[model samples]
Target: MTRSTPTKPQANPGAKPRVIHPWPLRLTHWLNAVAVVMMIGSGWQIYDASPIFGFTFPPLITIGGWLGAAIAWHLAMMWLLVVNGLIYFLWSATTGHFRKIFPLSPRAFWHDLTAALTFNLKHEPGVYNAVQKLLYFGVLCAGVVIVLSGLAIWKPVQLWFLTDALGGFVIARYVHFFAMAAIAGFLFIHLLLVAMVPKVLPPMITGGRIEP
Candidate 1:
């Protein structure tokens, strides 16, 4: 008599959904990264030309060789940033991306903040922890402020209302500078966390595998 082989178990189709970073989110994220780098570099060059603050960024670190070149690059990247931002916002709104960062609670934030400071925070793939949500929200607000301040600086005469609301060109410049600082700070911490948690990098690049 011939012996029969046992069947292997199949995956459950109704199991919990997997975490994915979705293509649209990934695309917008990378484009934003490129735009932010170019904008910041060129902006630094422009700042060096007529700095509001005492110090200036190193020439080597800045984009464009001169003020005029920097202005050109900055203007070009501005459009990319604006358009891409709009697309990201629209997509987020339509696809319920905002849900991930909503319902922020001070209690949760405090708890997570403590956990993070103590290095006890655990990262869940595809889910934004309280601290993460706050950071993301903060950056989004900074992005809007930066763009508006940039516009006020770029077209003070035409956008006189905006410039006036921001307390004129000088004040607008300050606002713009601080906004850039906020973004730079966020980027620094963001990169540091990525370095510490290298595994998280792959999911952002490749829509991560689902956990049961």
Candidate 2:
């Protein structure tokens, strides 16, 4: 039967595109995301008992019912965070990422600090500055503290040694709460900075390249 129908020309394929988020960053980001969500949910449950801001409403149920559930969720998420954070720390240390993030020179520190402040003031800040490094370091350290304090309070019977090491149950609880508050505060500032920059979120969310 007659001639074959003319076929449409196909475009030539090229090399695969590079993803923005490296495997390590993506894993850490997602694990942190899950952990933070669980932390917030359980935190609300725990807070229902005290009912700050003059609000006395329960979270999903009465204070006591949800509090135990919240603790369970919080503890589970804490394990995930601890494992993921440790992996990230080890990866960064072994690779050159740690050096890039934590510049040791005094001049570099001052330069980064100035750049960050200037950038905040509507001046051009080149990539991440010293303040950003410091913040990252602080968050990492805070995460460690949170995990230790959490263990001390959460498993006083099983981890009586840690509980005793950190003074007592009451002090451990207090430190855990403060660490949570610090992490929350950091989250607030992180969100604010992202909103202000808008450009920052795309890299983490879509694995897109961030243009300078």
Candidate 3:
């Protein structure tokens, strides 16, 4: 006689699936962060060499000890930024990430803005709130402008058309600077929000798990 054995049933069938940031998205994100930091630091040094504005970034914050070294570092990080950015764009497009940030409604944005200003906006993992969506979209646009303006500045002679399109080298520098400012501003707010909602930080670093 053979004894029949019963298999154990699966646990918590009703439990929500754990949501995580895809590895590709996370990888590209961190890479972009590193590249941005390097570029900003090195760019500051380069800017110090030829200040467009009266004020210059402090030597402590700038990367590279001298103008030449700063230029080298800036160019090197530019490549990383471009490559990583391209990967992110492709991944996001193919994976439909753009969808999360698009078709933004003025109504929704105003509502969210009011809620945020009043400190009543709820934080939800794995979802982009209206304010977040607007910020992401704006930053993405700024990134494109910065990259193109950078290239125009980098090889103004070879990329003369681009430089001209951006209203020449001097204008390109201003455009690039403003674009950097925008990104930096976004970074400041992003960090501030992260500080306010510390839990969001883990998901960025560790691809946090969340219940639906």
Candidate 4:
């Protein structure tokens, strides 16, 4: 004779409540996103003039003209990114959200690192691991470098002091390019991680609950 099997309890037949992202965080995130995209697109048009690779494409004529439009858009977006980033940073600090993201202890660091690595290997853990904290810190530092270097290059005459501080206009331009590349690299890795763990996207996007 066949025996009856036990059944598990089921969730209520209703849609989960829709949560919203914090206004400031959401605004800053989307603004930064738009700025980054514009910078990269316009930047490519500018870069084509120099042709880093063997291939060369026609110049961009969208915003104004080729390099002129690129420079204008890049500079404008630069200020937007700076203002948004500053607001986010100050808000996090004053609101104590900084502590949640920043690693406070060695034990916590190691634990987070292990958890993150394990999760990447398909052994999911609770929340963001240590590697995430380090990456976040790196992004913040890169943002600072980008802004300072950009100022030196954008206004070498007006910001002569910054140019000198950063070892001259040429050096500042190089630093700015490298910093932008670093930020782009971070974005690529971030997107890859999000694709790998789709559940992770909802919290930042919709302020929805993150499963434990």
Q: By lDDT, who's the top model here? A: 1
Task: Name the runs in model 1 displaced over 4 angstroms.
Answer: 1-11, 14-19
Kindly report which residue stretches of model 3 are placed more than 4 angstroms away from their true locations once superposed.
1-16
lDDT of 2 by residue, 1-212 (tens): 89999998765566365555667877787889778667766766776655444664455642236667777787788788888888888887786667655665667677766755566433222245555666677777788888898888778999999999888888886777677778878888778767767766666766765232
State the lDDT of candidate 4 residue by residue for 133-154, as single tens digits. 6777888899899889878877
lDDT (10s digit) by residue, model 1, range 58-155: 99999999999999999998899999999999999999999999989999999998998898999888888998899899999999999999999999
C-alpha lDDT of residue 170 in model 2: 82
TM-score of each: 0.91, 0.73, 0.91, 0.75
Regions more than 4 Å wrong, model 4? 1-21, 50-65, 104-127, 210-212
The backbone clash count of each candidate, in order, is 0, 0, 0, 1
Q: What overall lDDT goes with each candidate model?
A: 0.92, 0.70, 0.91, 0.73
Q: Pick the TM-score winner.
A: 1
Which run of 10 residues does model 2 get worst, by summed lDDT? 120-129
lDDT of candidate model 2 versus the reference: 0.70
TM-score of 4: 0.75
Candidates, ranked, lDDT? 1, 3, 4, 2
Candidate 2 positional error at 131, Å: 1.6
